[model samples]
Target chain A: MGIYRSNRWLVRHVDVKVLRGQLVYIIGANGAGKTTTAKALLGLIPTDEGEIRRGPALKVGYVPQRLHINPTLPLTMRRLLRLTERYKNTEIDHAITAVGLQRLGNPFVSTLSGGEFQRLLLAQAMLSRPDLLLLDEPAQGVDAAGADKLHNIIDRIRIELGCGVLCISHDLQLAMDTGDDFLVLIPHEHDEMDST
Target chain B: MTLFDDFLIRSLIAGIGVALIAGPMGCFVVWRRLAYFGETIAHSALLGITVAVVFSFNFMLGVLISSIAVVVVMYYIDRSENLPTETLLGLLAHGGLAIGLVVLSFFPNMRMDLEALLFGDILAVSKTDLVVIWIGGGVVFASLLFLWRQLLTSTVSEDLAKVAGMRPDLTNLCFGLLMAIVIAGAVKIVGILLIVALLIIPAATARKFAISPEIMAALAGLIGVVGVIGGLGSSLYWDTPAGPSMVVTLMILFALSRVLKISYGTTEKSATRNK
Candidate 1:
């Protein structure tokens, strides 16, 4: 399936399948439709061509490149994790611990360092026990060591939950061993179509 | 009239009731940075006033209908076109106000106080106005409390809210309906021109001191109540326009909060982030 924004297609003739416990890495450059593809796959945005299907009652957890917590709204990390759904005290603590953010002390989400922010998002994603997990550049703004830890955590989540994982990133070196399959997006594919 | 005893007391009660509901709704307006959107809602309210005048009915019901119509038209425009929202809001705001004024001009013999209709004649509030404010304001207040979680979630992230099956669009539609209801009740308190200021200033001021959403909402209400009381008292003593006086009082409060924020040196951590 493919999606279009404006008059031209963003991504066309794209096909990928992810089974339970499988990791699919969608690698692409800027404007390569990685984010758009992920959004379309989740039904967040509509696609212009082809059909997309998902298992019924599929629970989804998404870690976007950015989680816009408007500065106007004061939100503690604990509150951010609990914003979408209510969780038990122990369950919240467990998710924070799983993401190695156990030292969180009710700091506003805006105060988090970049890596801390990404990890915090990961913690929230895991809270729902999702059946399909999508991460959009999950290792963004993270140091190499932190990136390694993030990969390991994702791999563990995949094994533990047996959820299909879709990782959208530009970095080829990101968790090389974890990805069961890879899809690369080319920039200016629209240009190729325009020329023809 | 005898139950309320004094006109001053009646206006005070009326103003406070509007403040009570405005505080929480104002926070959502601020958090979502819908100050202009609120302005549009208020401006469209002027058109609602015109409809009421033409129909010879209760102004509150008339305002409610017109505002709902404007909101539906806005939703249609937003979905049907890619026009920048602000541009459309500007068009609707001025268009509604101008059309209402022109319509009012056509009926010069209607025996209406146009100034009272524009800037608000809060001190002239009748018994029915108070009843409308309390009963309607109470319902909006309760509904806001019930839908707090869904509202906050949608404000934070529409996608996340959608994932949670919260239906962000429906949540927003509910919010607009509530805002419209409040605007209907507010027309007599602050009128159309100054109603948004009453909604926004208190909430913005309260944000300086609040550490959580619930606190912010509560503090905003308190600020609004204080503004209304102070504004009305000053208006009585100094003979200023009641609605504008209240708005000016709110501004002073907001300025004081800025000073308080600076003196406390709360650091730049919580500085307002542009959306």
Candidate 2:
């Protein structure tokens, strides 16, 4: 897939595939189109070139890097979970417990700490039972210990759901350790088509 | 004597009908920060009036069409251009108002009172005006209720709404149309200049005490109703203009609400902090 702006390529010649039950990480430097590639794969943005064919009956769940909900928006965690799909109380409880956020008593989303918010987002993604989970900077704003715990949770979730996991992150050392396969995006000055 | 025969009675009914609709819609306006958008549509009602008079068309219909036109133009400009929404709205608001005034100046033979068009003359509301206000307000209210969930979700986060399969753009377009309907229906009762004040003040006042979106909307409607009653009563006693008096009444209520909230010592900021 390729993305261009004003006849200049922002991202080009990207070919990556995620398989079931596998963990793949897309690693890149800043402004190297890591998030752009993930968005394109999720069909959030159109690709200017090449074709992206998805498996039949594919269900993809996406957890964005950071969700900046308006402070005035009166959304509780329970209400937010209901926004994407209608889940029963038991299912919601299970998902919240799965994310290790069982202590929160339907707190307002604006009141959540950054790590807690990320866990809530992950719980939201888990609700769909998706065939593939796309996470962008999933450990962002998390402490080192919390990041490790989140990665462990991601591993367990992948194993339990048997779903493919594609994550975008700048933490190369962590990505190298966690990913089964890695796609590294290198920025080039010119708009040349190349892939590794 | 028939109730409709009394001009004051007619004005009260019309004003209350408008408040019922504006209150809830105003909540969305406040949440989305669309005050300027409302002002733009309200200001353009003058252009609609001028066009109706010049072409011998129905004034309300003219207003609806012109307001929708502004919505359409603003939508396209927002999508295609890089201009800030505030700049675009400022240009359109003053431009439409100025053009309407200039056009009206050309027709010295027109019988309509420009002052009434600008500041409103609610005491002169006819039975037909009541019908339009109530019916239009009903439709707007029903539409808002129907789209309430999706609208609230979209207001919270457009990206999340999209992921949830709700189309934010479509919701926004519908909202713009609803605003047009309200502005057109209200132009005769509150005038173009003061319509936004009615839409914004009560909702802002409600925000101080509301714990949820539904409560905020309900409180806004209640406050608006009280403002209408108080303003109309004071206007009858003092022999003052109805529209501006209503706005002043709303402002006073808003001030009172703030004072009461502060004194009661349960401010939202403190409550959130405690949480």
Give me the displacement of residue B175 in model 2, in angstroms.
Answer: 1.3
True contacts kept of each: 0.39, 0.17
Which residue pairs show collisions in model 2? none
User: What does candidate 1's lDDT look like per residue over A1-196, in tens digits?
Assistant: 8776787778977798888889999998889889899989878888888888888888999888777777768777788888888898888888888888887566777788888888888888889999989999998778889888888888887887789999998887653655789888886544564433
Mind giving the per-residue lDDT tens digits that candidate 2 earns over A84-158?
677888888888888888876776677788988888888888888889989999998899999988988888888
Model 1: residues with Cα > 4 Å off, grouped in runs: A143-146, A175-177, A187-196, B266-275
In model 2, which regions exceed 4 Å deviation? Answer: A193-196, B263-275
Task: Please write out the lDDT profile of model 2 over residues B135-187, one tens digit for every residue.
Answer: 99989989998898889878876766776678899999999999999999778
Score every model by TM-score. 0.92, 0.91
DockQ for all candidate structures vs. native: 0.41, 0.33
